[model samples]
Target: MISNPAKEREVRPAPPDPALDGLLTLSSAQVLVLASGGCHSGYAGDLCCCLLAAVQGALTASSYAQSHILAPGQALALYQCGEFSIQSVGEGVCMLVQLQGDLPGRLLASRLTDSAAFFPRGGAAVREAVLSLSVLEDEHALVSGTAASSYAYTMLTNLISGPSSEAVIGQGEPLSPLVEAAVGIIQEEFPFLEGLDELAERLEVSKAHLIRTFTKQTGISPGRYITHTRVEYAKLLLRGVDPSITYVAEASGFANANYFAKVFRRETGMSPSEYMEITPRKEPPKRDPFLW
Candidate 1:
């Protein structure tokens, strides 16, 4: 978003590399920018907040690759620092929206669209957005154009924020072609996979292509993104326990419950049910602007 989409990703190359540059944006504290990778993939990150308080570097993996976000200065920190490399977090992609710092934390304040979902992973959830300075008022103005175009554009923003009373602004340039296509596949085809190869087929994209596009746009691999989504839903089930494990397993795209249990433990550091015990089971409540 900081640069034009057609402009190449200034970060690292496709394979493991010591110099990977990843980028995202934050316009104002009231406007938020979220970086997300694939859903449950071990290395792919889920949506994470832009440091709202301090004006300094919000988060970083290493010194060399750091984001200097102020209204715009930015950089990418890669983990391939030494000879040994850890799978980079957010190596895939992240999203930026103008937000209302006026609202505390991740309170989805209001939505700019109704028919679209906020996440590419799936579900029809309403989410708030921060519009770009060019797009009209930062917090006002509806997403326009064709239904599909608006939906897709809004979906991109929503994927970063998800369904909630959020604060987002979609006034940046259009997405990279690769990112646009990759997110499209993620939203439209992820629900029908039997395995990695099968999922790749649905997009008419190769395994490598899927991974690269997703990583570039969202900062993680497609497989990992899929994993992140399934696991997140699994977490809800494990915590809420409203749906049985078997049901969660299926809904989360796990072909077998036992397999789901093993992976869930690895990703979350606990079995599904076990995670619910220590982590607690409730969404972070919405902020009361009145209290502050």
Candidate 2:
């Protein structure tokens, strides 16, 4: 049986959504998470720049009568000078960083011919950096405002001017149809997935071939990917009010609570209860008016 740890710490309230008009006045960078199907919009003349990067799943960004689809590891920058909206494509998790002043301008001055630009390729470093920021935010580790700002600035600067070489597959590389289908299934039906053999069967490939191709292309094995997807889903559930560990375990595809705790600890270095102590309780879901 799992021990309840939600009672140990005072749950922090969710941060208020930042006002689009007030973004220009921010003294430090602000990170916002866009859940699946959620939408965020800003009007023209907001006087701030934002970097939107897809962490999981995908995103659709629209502005100036243009729309672009952003797969994981892809990013785009918006100057907020014209009306724009970002919507998650499915079970997407995206990170949006709002910066004050001309920080983004200085960082991307050399690369960005237009203020609003899509970086469909070569954003792997940027994606990794933003993902780190997301982890920091979720773990409540950014207690020092200055430290957070410094980290955000460094990430933005590196994104535009850093070395372009990538160790794994290039972020711009298009996914193969087989791999893409596998990823979509993992994201949408992680809880129901039996194993890599099952995935391989569905994809009409041998298990060994599936492992080789998935790891070669995505830098991770299919088994590990499924584990990651399930863990992420469990994290989301834990952030809600008074979640039960057993339920989370079952819902996240773990066969039993004990196994879930073991895997969760192996991946995160903390038990579910300990994680709950640090993560802020999320507010109830609501629909945004700007979704398209």
Candidate 3:
């Protein structure tokens, strides 16, 4: 099992490297801009608390055994931060606000825990605020002085003071591209993706290699993720106008309603009919106000 890093408060000592040490402990924390498919992977050292805000494009990040994808206008509160790996899905830029004092911890805890998650639309103000910080950092060299430093510090403080209830947990490591491609195929062709052979043939990798690579990257077997996705789709159909279980099962790529029901119960902890009774029909998500 991947142990929870958030519960541990111990700080690892900083290594004896001047450049890295300065980079981590900078008064004006580093602004990293990653191109498409680029990644930043490493240990956190002494810098445990941080604010990760996406500036452009999308970012898939994994830290503390949890992974999340952040698009523009989204941000994350990361704590017990250690050995994080953030990769740009497309062209993206992110600011790493290294927490230095007790206030950072106190403010972050009020808004989020190690698992706190925020929706795409809700983090607009926060993202904009962080983007502004990056802009200031870029211009700092032009106007280097106490005044510039003070302004940056104040901005960082104002950031934590905003409404933090939107925070939510981001869990899991990022999937490698090859594994992600295989997942896409399974999700789209749930019925045809019958066994390891079919999936491996589609991916052009050996069956054993595919299974091992996919499981290692996603922390879940490919078969399990595929099964789970189908069940989730079935639930959506069940809650819709399609009331026939057989139709729902077929549409969800299941061969029979009885089999569908059994899988659904095992995965959802309830019968299909019972699930429909308790769960509300989900509406399509509204456009994120933060997205232009």
Candidate 4:
């Protein structure tokens, strides 16, 4: 994990990656990891800026006039006129990309203004790009910076081009208190959650009622949500230094290696081993230049 000392948080320049070649260049960028309760605040100035993704955990991002919670796979584009702050609700990690040129104009035209626009679920391509950046190996830090810039550009473009309906939150009906509580418990305890029955028991609600309300509100069943959460966690582990399928399986809360493989394949269209093979082996950056 990225180390954060009590007095300061280190921010490292985006390491170069050949895989990110052919994308738009960025003026500046950095990746930082926040421990529980860590906070990073800054001003946007004249550049186009965004919290490209909260790669892991939950974050509370706020601007002078607005604030929103960003879960994993979510992003927020900042309005250039104000100061903004991002705080980890728990242990969190995120990337900041600042761009020059016409990108800011494009963002303003796309309706980014006083309020920061939130991208609820940055689709698969965006997810993969962000993940790749998050896991870049520190050993390859000497490579060209083109790839890293391109990847950042690609993520921003994809987010801006998405349908606006899915980009904004707070417009729809708020989730029921029961469903919200259940989601909180799932996110925090996904690695050790026993089953739907256990979750229902914790909330003092019947299993059927819990399932119906959660599915209706979130568009996915609790069991499936649990599996998805496990799979997301597993993806991070599989992409990490460890190469053992069994270790990843147990760590991700699967009952057994065999069952883990089955569920993994069903969710990702590949076995754990295959997924690892495709992920690049990179170390975390050792040097840091910025502080948060």
Best by TM-score: 4
Clash pairs (backbone) in predicted model 2:
none
Q: Looking at candidate 2, what is the lDDT of residue 273?
A: 95
lDDT of residue 104 for candidate 2: 52
Candidate 1 residue spans exceeding 4 A from truth? 1-175, 279-292
How does residue 174 of candidate 3 score in lDDT? Answer: 67
TM-score, per-candidate, Cα-based: 0.38, 0.50, 0.38, 0.53
Instruction: For model 3, name the residue pairs that clash.
Output: 66-171, 66-172, 67-171, 67-172, 115-169, 116-168, 116-169, 117-167, 117-168, 117-169
lDDT of each: 0.35, 0.60, 0.54, 0.61
Residue-level lDDT tens digits of model 4 in 78-156: 7564678889998876766654434444534565657466776542224434334434433455323554554554455
Q: For candidate 1, write residues 1-292 as lDDT tens digits.
A: 0122111111111221111111122222122222332121111122222221111112222222332221111212112122111122332222222211222122322321211112222232111122122222322332222211222223233344433211111234455765555444443233345555765676577878767765665556667766665676455445431236665676556877898899898887888777767854432122342244
Among all candidates shown, the one with the greatest lDDT: 4
Candidates ranked by TM-score: 4, 2, 3, 1
* Residue-pair clash count for candidate 2: 0
Question: Candidate 2, which segments miss by more than 4 Å at Cα?
Answer: 1-38, 43-47, 121-142, 162-175, 180-206, 212-292
**Residue lDDT tens for model 3, 181-266:** 77656643454356668788878899888889987876677777777756755654565422567666765667688988899999
The C-alpha RMSD of each candidate to the native structure, in angstroms, is 19.0, 11.7, 17.8, 8.7
Worst 10 residues of 4 by lDDT: 1-10
